[model samples]
Structures are given as structure tokens and as C-alpha cells.
Target: MRLRSIVLIAALPLAMLAQGRRNAPPETPSTKTPAELRAEYIREHYTKAEYQIPMRDGVKLFTAVYTPKDHSQKYPILLMRTPYTVGPYGSDNYAGRLGPASEKFMREGFIFANQDVRGKGRSEGTYMDIRPVNPNKRGPKDIDEPSDTYDTIDWLVKNIPDNNERVGMYGISYPGFYAAMGAVDAHPALKATSPQAPVINWFIGDDFHHNGVLFLAHAFNFFSGFGRNHPPDGPNRDRIEMKTPDAYDFHLRTGALANYDEKYFHGQTEFWKELTQNDTYNEFWKSRDLRQYVKNLKPAMMSVGGWFDAEDVFGPLNLYKSAEAQNPGAKNMLVEGPWSHGGWARPDGTALGNINFASNTSKFFQDDIEFPFFLFHLKGKGDGDKLPEAYVFETGRNEWHKFDAWPPKDAKWKTLYFHAGGKLNTAQPAEKAEAFDEYVSDPAKPVPFTPYIANGMSYPYMTDDQRFAASRPDVLVYETEPLESDVRVAGPLKASLFVSTTGTDSDWVVKLIDVFPGDTADPQPNPTNVHMGGYQMLVRGEPFRGKFRKGFDKPEPFVPGKMDQVAFDMPDVFHTFRTGHRIMVQVQSSWYPLGDRNPQKFMKIQDAKAEDFVKATERVYRTNSAPSSIQLSTID
Candidate 1:
């Protein structure tokens, strides 16, 4: 990639999205893929520079800046602070793919900056996981993401030549977490930021755990490489070789959680040990949760996430709500789409698995929402009115909705009660008063999150068909006959269950699904055996360790055969169950590998042995007195 050639490509806009977000789009696709265009544009128009920027704590963090060659005008600095390395460390070398953010910013012309936060990558300093914010900072000695960001911004405005003082911050996942923190006590130059898929709460709902159930596969696999506490020289890890392709076989054969830790991971992974030790939602975990300290937020902030994101979906929703509630009248916006983790930042978001969204959702969001947002705040190129308080995509229906507030003012709360004979309806449970559905959940045969065999957590499983599980005897399925008309759901969901276990402890896995018509046509450009017809698409599902039913901080053993009220919040929902589509709900005890087996015992899970694992008779009651139901907010 030559500089002259790169400059030519950058000067000439790419066939797709070269024109900013507002104008007409090409009817057909471009000859060059977006990735190709982005690469060429970066090589030609942008010159890379590596710097070791000093933070307030006097630690020099590694930073990379991509400056547009067109020096006719100064541009706003778009910064991303991440624990992920700032690679292509030299002036001659450039990143393989500059990520989705590059596509928009390259043509639009801005000073794109990517930095290695505190300790990871080529950066100097000790790295901490979800570094605790020093709420009562007295001096430059108290360091955190916000302080580091402030110091970085201060340096950039002072040191970087030919640049506007105005700055914008953005990142996905861990970087998103940094972006959110940067907005707090932001520098005068820091104007706005977007935290896409930020990790807000690990205990409540995030990557590490969800509702107190350890996402074993994700925790083990991710931490094996990412969770290490490297010496200043740095710690590098090779990707773990899989003993088997199927996680079920691997985890099951390992016998118990502690056995696997002792044999493979050992004490090498620091976070795993911390995770195992801090089993409850104690202050150690609470200190890292970002929601507690997101007050007096500076700058215009927009939190973005995917409705189907398996990891960190709870982040943007809760982060936005907290910021909004605490600092009302602030331009705290929210955008959720039909995406996986960071899916909106990709090229194609028209479909995932067998489902079709009927539009290039990724592009639509980048152009219509994200691009406009940065342009308005950073460059004053567009009116801020283009951005809304809440811009949510209506899945199933495949449309966009703008609201002054989420759960639109007219949204009505409706509870679909679980009834006998596997029926679900707005009508209260009218099954036999003494009726209950029972399934024997065995640790030996834990229910697979997906029927497919894979070593790691599958993001697609969030929307994967549940027909396999629904058919299993260990699982119970209930559904509405068929929707009378299109029912658009727009807000959070609540699962209220009356359950009992023969064992002292158990796990409850609930799934909300959409059953397609049996005659539904298969999606285009598809794979064989998709079975779109009669497919059961999972909309939202979560697992709760039965002990957490009391609270996350404390664990209570379930008395045998004693049915109790168990209710928890499902992340949130934004889907339409179209006319002729059946709304189904499934319940079971295990989602193996994805969620650790509960062992059905009262003992400490972190130290549980093979002998502790047992089979349990689980019962879901829909009796008149103890009706189990899921409450949803709908737009009529």
C-alpha cells in the first residue's frame, strides 16, 4: 500500500458511505468491500504516529494517532482508550483493519486516536480490571480511567499541532467502559462520547456473570488469556488448545469446576481466582461496577448496545438509564439495534443465523445515528436534532422508533401467565388448581445452551432455535396459540416464577422465544437444514442461580418441595411477534458451559466436588395461587 495510492483512494470517496450519513445511498452494492476501502483509505490519507503520552500519575501510556493528510483545516480528535493493544506500533506499519469507526471518520476527516490504556499492550503502568474509580480524589496520585482520559486530553490539546481543542471519545466493549468513565469529570476539551457495549455490571448482568450464575465457558476461555496480571515486561499467553470440540464433553469430563481450575488454569489466571473467591456480590465486585459512580456526568453521552448481544447487553441500557436518572436534562441518549456484541460496528447486520432484518442495519445506524452524532457535537457539521433521546430498532417488524423516553409513554404493561396444558396467554392461569410441571434435571445430562458442539460460548445462541431444548423432557414449553395481530414489545421484561426443587439448590433457565409459522419461507443466501419454518427463535433468555433468589449478596438453600416466589429482571426486549407468529416461553434447570451447573446442593459452589453434584426434581407451578408469568411492555 503506497502513500500516493492511499492518498488517491482517500481523496476519492468509496462507493459505499463515502457520502456522509444524510444523502441518498447507492441502489446496488459496491465493487470493493468496505474493508478494502477502509484499508486503502488509511494507507493513503492517514499518517500514523506512535506516542507515549504521560498521565497525571506520571505513567506514560502508549498511544496511536491517525492524522488526515489534508491539513487545509483542523479536525476534532476522536479518541479511543482501550486495554486492547494499540498495534502497528510504528509509522511505517498500519492496522490490518482499522475497525468500523475508521470507515466513517476517514472520509469525514478527523484526527482518529487509539491508545493503550494503563497497562495492556505497549503501554507502561500496572493494569487493573475494571479499575475502581477514586470517587474522593484529592490529588493527581489518585488514578482512574476518567483521570487518565482528562490527562490524555490535556496533553493532546497542548501537544498535538493543527487540531481543534474539541475532542470526542468512543470504544466498544472494554474500550466502551473507558469511554463511559472518560465522560465523568471530563476535560474542558472533551465534548462528547459513545460507549458501545460497555461493561457496566459484572454481578448483575455482564460478561463475567449474569444473575449470580458464572458463565463458565466465557469466564475460563476469556480469562485464560485476558485476565492475567502480567509483570511490567508483559505477560503473553498462547490460545488454549481444546481437548475436544464439544464444550459439553470437555466440561463434563473435567468433573467439577475446582478440578478443572486445579488441572488446567491453576492459579495462573488472577481474575479467575478472584472470581472464584468473590462468589457473592460483595464490595470487591461492587467497587468495579460502573453504575455506582456515573454521576455529574460531563459531555453529551450516548450508550449503544445490541438487543441480542450475549455479553455486555445489560451495559448500555443500565448505564444510559443511570446517567439519565441522575442527571436529568442531559443529552444522555440510547440506541439499541438487532446486533450482537459490537455488531453495529460491522459491515453487515441485515441478518443473523436464519433471521432477516430486511435492511443493512449496520450501515443505517452508522450513517443515520452514529455518524451524525459525532459530526454535530465534534465538528458542528450537522444539527444535533438528528440525534434522539432514544433510537431503538424494532426487531421482527424491522423498523426504527424514536421516543422522548424509553418504554414509550403510552406503552402498556401486560403479563402473559403460564397455564396448564402448555398454554400461555393474557388470561390468568386457569389450569387445574393443583397442577404443576415437573422435570428431572440431572447434572450428568445438563441442558446444552445450543445443540451444536463448540468449545466457547456462541453469540448466535442468544437467538438460536430452542426446538431442541423444548423437545427435551427436562425442559417445559408454553406458548400462545398465535398472535391475533402484530404485537410490538419495546421495553424491559420481568420473569416471575413459582418454582421448587427436590435438591437444596438449583438453577432456573428461562427463555422467551418467537415461533415462526410452519409454512414460513426459508431465508435467502442460506444454509441447508435451517428449518426457518416452525423455527423457535430465542428473543431473550437468562439463567439465575436459585440461591440468588433471595439476593446476590446472600445465598439461601431451597427447602425440598417448598415452592417459593422467584422473580428477576430479564435484560430488556424490543421485538414484534407478528400476526400468525406464536409467542413461546421455555423453562429448564441448566444451560451447560454457558452457565455452570448448579450441582443442586447448598454447599459453596467454588469448592464443590464431584460428590456434591446430583439430580434434582424441579417443578414449575402455575396453580391459581402461585401463577408463574412473564410481564412485557407492549405498543398496541
Candidate 2:
């Protein structure tokens, strides 16, 4: 089975942004599709041209430019730089739709440009994964992402025909990283930037790793296709063909992490090799941290991400915060919606799996937030200053909320403590001599992150029902009674776990859930025949490697049967548990193939032998002296 196709269909937002029809009268559906109409429109009104734009370093990068044929008026340029192919290569071959994920932009007549980053596609140069930003460049050869972007914008504004000097950059996922880079040393013409779900740090909390834990399935599937080498003009390599359809079985059967290279990669994938070698947070990973380079941002900035983005949830939040802190008084804004990875770019954001968000959240972002952002900054058409500092979607409430600051300063911090009888409450637990919950974490039979069988990271898994996990013996479940009033959680969650393992090391997985009332009504269609009543919905979940409990840079072993602290902050959430809903917390040691299984020993996990994989009993203390709790930032 080729897992790449499955992952692409699930994770990527391939659908073109549908033309808004808010106030128009309903008409008969036409035979011509939206894509066809877009293509026709582009062919008639736009002229496509390809160029090998030269960088400061003599190397030339491939860029595709689309200028409006009706060049009677000057227009601002909207640019997108991506490692992914800027295909439909020839000048005659125009993209069906263009311009920062909206058809409106294309129709409104902005000069759109898409470029193949250095070393990818037709661009000249070797590609470095998450290329580190160079703070000091004495010569032309000391090139980085920021420098490349600066050069690209400089070339576009100077060489492009009949164009306004102003420029805006935007991209999703990998391209989003490039968009962020464009803002660092922004050109004089570069006025606006929106890095939607950008790739921030790979080793810390991005696509591959989260809190020092490798997201096994995501890393494997992504590397299978993207990690392979590509010639300057040759076709990219295909994804690996696996014998089994079940990724869980395949990964478990593959045994140790070392076996991956020996059996499949065979050291051909340089990035995977680097990942295995740098098992701990070291100089290699730290150098690629984008947060360190967010200082002195010049462009008007807007960082956008989904609250439940399966990938890069940590990126936009941290990127926004970093720019805000590093570049004081800069035009920095953040917009987080109730969608998946790049879901805001898709046509529909009404629902994910069985969870209904109750509105077209994506349309709202594009029309009201994103489009206006670019228009105001790049064209000086709208009042961009009217936009809030933070525009976030309230999940359970299914509504948009604007805040002067993220995690609203007025929001109170509350702790939900675990107690006997599987109870969770804000009140402190009463004194007890021996208060704890214990479970066996077996490497051979690790708990699956999702109940469904999938070959890669499932996009809907972020909000999938958690009842399947809650019923497991390995997962310890604790919940508060139906809330007396609505509980609104608005910011990051901190898990303060007092744990002990029978072995030297372990992994700690914490999940926040919303349990619906038993009498809740099911949806009308119910095609999947899902059970609505008493449904345990997963709001947010994260895995932490026990060794990194003290610090990401430091690794320590847990003394057998000795209590140790394993605390970490999870990504922010904007969720509300209604009055009839119960707030649940589930704690487990292993999340299976979603996160690579911990060897339960202190040695480097990437280099651990088969003998290191052992079963261990894990304990979560809930006494008056050593109580385990989750700190939540809540709004009134």
C-alpha cells in the first residue's frame, strides 16, 4: 500500500477557494465547474510568464509570474515561494486559480507570482530542510531563506510590468515558512505577509516531533515522499510501497528506529539520518528554530492557523507571539479558526469528521479577515487597523471571537485536579496517605492513538471521538460532573504530572476531552451511524518524552518507583464545554504509532536495542502532597 496518496487526500487542502455568493440569487447549477470557470477567466484576463530570477549569489531561482492582461492600472504583487513544484511550467500553461488562496484576489487583478525555492523544481541550489536563517551575512554566498525572499521581491518589483510597488506574500504549510521568511528582512516594496500554518521547528513542535517525541506515522509517511532527493529538473521520487495497509502493524513490526534506515531508507534520506542522529534537542535543531530569527519584522504580519491543525499547530501560535515580542509595535496579528491543517484554504470548513462547527469558518476567514488584510496593507483599500490583534474561533460555541490579546489578559487560570473515584475538579483533592492511579505500559501492545486503522496521520484524529481510548485499560480516565455553567478554555494547557515508572524512562500522554450528555441528539443524516450521546470528544492531545521532563536540552532517567515531575505546556485551545457537558482528562503513557514507542529506558531512544523495549508499570500520583493536575486558561 502506498500511504502517500492517503495522507495527501486527508491532509492537503486541494480544493480551490470557491467564489463567494453571499447575497446573490440562487441560479441553476451550470455544467462548467468552478475550476473550469477559473481557468477560462485566467486564460482571458491573465498572461503567464516563467523566469529564472537571479539571487544575490549568482544562482538563479525559477519563478512563474501572472500579470493581468488589462494592465491599464498598476497592481500590487502577491507572491508565494514554495519548495513544492511551481508547475504548469510553460508560459502558455496558466494555473486555474491563483493569488493567496482566493479567487477574489485573482478577479480583483493582483500580479500573482509563484516560485520554486532554491534546490527544488527548476530552481538552482541544494535544498536544506527548514533552512536556518543567517543573522549575519558578510558576503553574497551566505544566503538564507530571508535573503532569497528579499532578492525575489526585489526582482519582482523591479522587473515585473505595470505593477504597483507594494507586495504581499502568503502560503500554507511549507510555503507558509517561506512567507514568514519574507518578512524578516523585508524589501521596501514588501508590505504585507500572512504565514498560514507555517513550519516553525521540526524537532520541537512542528510536523515531525512534538515536545521531544517523534510523530512516527507522520514522519515516516512524509519522508517516504518528501525526504527523497530531487534533481534540478527531474521528476520527484515516489512514495515507498509497504506490504501492509495498517501503519500501526507495519511500524510495530519494523522494530527499533534503527531498523528503519537498515530496512528501507538505507541512509539515502539525509534528513531522516539527521533526525536519527540528533535524538536530543541540540545545536542542529536549535539552529533551525525560526523563533530566534523573528526580530525586527518589517512587513505588516498576520499569522493564521487552525485550532485543531494536525500539523504545525505550534507554528502559527509561536510565530505570532515571537514576532510580537521581538518586534515591538509591529503590525502583528493572529487568526486561529476551528479547522484542520490548511483547512481555511479549502471551500468548506463547516465540519471535520463527526464534529460540526456550525458555519463556513473558512469563508469567514478569507472574505472578512484574510482578503481585507492584504487589500488594506498592499492596496491601501480598507481600514486594516480596525482588525483585532487576535481573531480566534470558539470551538464548542461555534463562533468567532476577537481579542485584544491572545489568551485574553482578563482570563483566569484554573487547575483541574485528579482525585479518587475517577473524579476531576477545580477544588484541591483532600489529604490521602496513598493516592495514585497505576497502569501497565507495554511496548509490544502499545495504545493506538486512534481507533481507526490508518496508514498515516489522520487529519480528523485531532477532534475524533475519544471514547475508544477512554475505554482502554491502559488509559486512565478522569472527568468532572456535567458543568453547572459553561466552561470556556481559551489558552494553552499545562499538564503537571507527578509520575513514576517501573523502568528507567517513559512517555506521558495527556488528553483534554469534552463528554456530551447521554441524551444529546444525533445529527440528521448520521451516515456513519455515529453515537452522539455520551460521546467523548477529543479537544486536544499531546505526548511528552519523559527524558525531556527537566528540559528539552537535558535528558534524565526516572528512578524505578520514584516519583518525578513530567510537566509540559500543550498548544493553545479555544473550546467551551457546555453546561450539560463534562470536562474529561485522560492520561496514558503510550500513544502508539502516532508517536514512536518509548523504549522505557534512559539510553538514546533512536539508538535503543530491541532488549530496551520493555513493559513498565506507570503511576500517576494524586495525593495532597503530590497532586497531578492540568492548568487551564479560562475566560469568563
Candidate 3:
């Protein structure tokens, strides 16, 4: 019996190994979603704790702290301050999930903290949207996000038990705005930060508007929820009622921008009213911009954004550039992926729409960049150089790249000029042939931003096939032949258009696209319903409010039937027009509902009536004297 027992004991290791191998999960399939598994793991390992953390101005903010149950070692802090409600409402009620980046932070053992920004959610005080920093702040009573963050950090390090002296901060969008603000005049304990898709300047770019052009659907829906004043007991989910499912039809029927307040809002949303009132980059809008204030940043910062980000793509680029320009010595890193707004926060990052990034890009970012960043900076537990200076993912090619500087130091600037009969070429225009393409831009039948049917701003439309838009007579389509060589674009695309309008005012919407060949193949056994063949993938697009052509603050009326220069910079495109793909450009006067109609008359559009809307004949000149061309920052 003793000899049998010894033999069984010796066989135990082999038996366990064989059992583990037999029970292993399949490479292709999983019984549960990643989110479900992460949620379960977080709930089991962490405990929920709530508190009222006091800010510098004596404002007590509601905060939720999730600490690891294991007391084996002290953990560093990861903080996020947001206007978005951080609640399950009770001390015992834990969040469905915890941590800054997946369950990775929780699993790695960090004390995660989420706070309701002053005047938001359960926090005390009057809430302000994109709250401006007070550069001249002197007294303890004077406060802003930075001050609030400083006070919060001061309290956490001293009061919280089993905490290491280091701290890290991160958030997306509005919370991202807070993360940026916190980095300015950072707390001593605040050692690292990752502000993913931060809101930079609302008036110029990010969310509400782009280069002074109003984003109607995003602004309207967002203000109805986020911009409205909520009572202490009021729910935060109130949305503007869409009269019809068709956005283009609804906006056209709704008439002018005046209708939003008179019909639907009834003066309820204060910020919407404020937004309309300020049409230019006045002190009001400029003060709220975070770029000017992001100086002398002590935190080891990593600014993350997506190339196809529906919102805040401008933020990451501008913020990183600003820090480099303003505060030279600060450790500023940028990572831009081929993602929509906040796509990196989710589990699946393999592909979007018809495009396959070939790998789980988000997983790579979390595992390789984001987690390693804080772990090294705050915990001193990982390699410091894991995340590179400028780690950007190249679209079309679907590959990751690291650069010493952004816009790539070696990019060759080239112009893709428009020619007669919708041909876009790299050659210069003929000196004598001063030709122009004309299109009738009717406000009554304005161009839809996307072909799909949706109530609000469709984020997927950012990368959605532009084939539908190309078919429209109102939209002038220009394209190059299927590329002979892979032409990679590394920087911003600038549109230098010489346009004339029959009416006094108009808008110029320019789109840069990658036209996939009809014979091109999608991934094997395609996972998405999107047709990849002949897809005119919208790489980058932006609308320039024509009145702001001469200047943003100064309104200029276009001389009727006379050519005037309307040039503006479109967002940067870190994409490659593959060897078999064609490069395309689509130009139009109006993108309805996506942007408020121009009324085709040069008075204050915000106050224009239904009758003010008119059709206009717009001409885009493509000649040597006044050549309409798009300049790209091409990289070898």
C-alpha cells in the first residue's frame, strides 16, 4: 500500500499536466466574452470604497475607489476625474468594471480611483463644460481642474492606506480633458498620464465644431445630454427628440439654426445657446482651449488618439505638438491608431468596418504601450522605454511604426492638382487652360454626410465607403489611377481651392479617399458585412465655413461669380494608398445635418429663417492662374 501511494504521488505532476492540456481553451473560440471574464475577475479581486474628496476651493467631489483585497504589497494610484457620473450610487455597490485600462491594471494590483468633477454628478458645485484654467490663480479659493486634481492627489497620498507615493492619471474625451488639465501644474505624486483622445479646442476642432464649421448632429445630441443642467435627482440621459429617422430630411425641414431653440430646446440648454452666441474664436472659446495651458508638464505624458477618430483627433496631435513647442524638456509621447473615438478602450480592435488592421491593435496598445507606461513611471515595475516617442499605426498597410518626431522629419511635400474631367494628378496645370468645374448646391437638397440611415452622428461614417457620396452630381469626384507604387501620406492634407459661388455665403467640404480596386481581396471569410471591393474609404474629410475663408473672426462675403481663394488644412492622414488602390478627392458645398446649412446668403446664419435658404451654383477653379489642388505630406 505504501509503495502504491509513493507511485501515485510521483505520477501526480504528469496527471495534472495532461488534465491542463485537455482543458485548454481553443485559439479561435471562447465560451465567454473578454468583458464578461474581466468583470468577474475585477469583482472577485477588488473591494468598492466611496468618499467625498475635498478640492482646493472647499468643493467636495464624489469619488469611487477600487482597491485590491490582497495586502501583500502597497500599490500606486491611478486616478480619473470626469464629468460623466462615476456611480453605482452606494458604498457597497461596485462598478461593473474597474481600472484605467481593462482588468490589466486591476490584475497588476493598483488602487484605481474615479471622481466626479466639481459640479458634476454627485459632486457639489456648479458644473462648467470644458472648464477653462485660471492661469492667474493665486488664492486657495480660486480653483480649476488642475487645482482640483492637486488637492485630490494631496488627500489620496496622505489619507489612503497601503498606497505607494506615486500616482498616474488617464481618461478618454471629457475625462481626457481633465487628464490634460491635471498635467498642467501637476501634483508631486502625479508621475504619469495618458489622456486618450482629449478634447483640445472646441471652437476650432474636437467635437462641437471643426475650423468654425458646426457639427450639427454631434453638437445637438451632446448638448441635450452633457450640456444641459441636471437637478440633483435628475437623470443624465436626456436626449433631443429626432422628429424623423432621416437626419438630412429632418434638418432641412427644421429650417434654420434658430429652430433648435425656438422649437426643441426652448432655451433649456444653456451651453447650446452659448455656443450659438459665440460664432468666432473669441476670448470665450480660446480660453477653454487646453493647448496654450499645457506647459511645464512634469508628468511622463503619453497622448493617444486615432487616425479615424470621429472626435478629438485634433487634440492628441495639437497637445503633443504644443508640449514639444512650449515645454521642450517634458517627456511628451504620442500614439495614434486607426480607431474611432475611444475604440482602444474596448476589447475588440482587430478591424473596423471593411478594413482589417490584421492584429488586435487595441490589445497591443494596452499590453505593450499603455500598461507598461504607468507601470514603469508610477510603480517602477516595468521597462521605461516600452512606449516609444511617437508610436503611430499606419492604415491601409495595417502596420505599427515608431518615429523620432511627428509629421516625419523626412516627408516630401507634393501637390495633387485637379485636372479636367475629374482626373487628379501629380503634374502641374496647363498655363492657358483656366478651367473650372461647376455644381449646383441646393440647400433644399443638400449632400448627406453618409449614405446610411441614422439619427445622430455615425462614427462609422468616418471610415465608411464614400462610393455613395461619389455618385452624387452635387459632389465633384476627382481620382488618380490605381497607384503604380505605394504612396504613403505622413502629415496633414491641405486643400487650396479657388472657388466662386452664385450666393454670398457657402461651405466647402473636401474629402481625401482611398479607392480600393474592384479585384482587391478582403480578409478570408470576412467577419463584417461591409463590402471591401471598390470601397472608397474616407481617409480624411473636413468642412471649412466659407465666410471664415479670409479669417476665422472676420466674415468675408464671396463676390458673386468671381473666383476667391478658400484654402484650409484638413486633419493629418497617416495612411498609405496601397499599390493597387487609387487616390480620390470629393468636393462639395454643403454636408447637411452634419453641418448647419449656409442659407446661401451671407448674413448671420444662426439667425437666418427658413425662407433665407437658397440654392447656389458653386465653381471650383482648376487652372494655372487659379489651380485647385490638394497638397499632401508624402513619405518615402
Best by TM-score: 2
TM-score of each: 0.93, 0.95, 0.93
- Model 1 residue 567 CA deviation (Å) reads 0.3
lDDT tens readout by residue for model 2, 1-636? 122233344554544212223344555655776677778778878889999999999889999999989968999999999888888788998887798666768867899999999989889998888899888899999999999999998999889999889999999999999999988877888999999999999887999899989998988888887758655555656557677779989999999998998988877789998887898899999998998888888889999999889988999999998998898888899999988999999999999988999999999898899999998988888877699999999999998999988879888899999998899998887767867999999999999988898887889998889998888899999999899999999999999999999999999999999999999999988999988899888999999999998888999888999998888999999999999999999999888798998999889887888898999999999988888999999999
Best candidate according to lDDT: 2
Model 3 agreement with the true structure over 116-150: per-residue lDDT tens digits: 98887789988888889989999989998889999
Question: RMSD to native for every prediction?
Answer: 4.5, 6.6, 4.6
lDDT of 1 by residue, 222-268 (tens): 87677554433345454455567888788888777788668777677
Regions of candidate 3 where Cα sits further than 4 Å from its true position: 1-16, 19-40, 229-234, 522-530
Q: In what order do the candidates fall by lDDT, top score first?
A: 2, 3, 1
- Tell me model 1's lDDT, rounded to 2 decimals: 0.85
The 10-residue segment with the lowest total lDDT in model 1: 230-239
Candidate 3 lDDT at 11 equals 59
Query: What is the C-alpha local distance difference test score of each model?
Result: 0.85, 0.89, 0.85
After superposition, the stretches of candidate 2 with alpha carbons farther than 4 Å from their true spots are 1-30, 229-235
What RMSD value applies to candidate 2?
Answer: 6.6
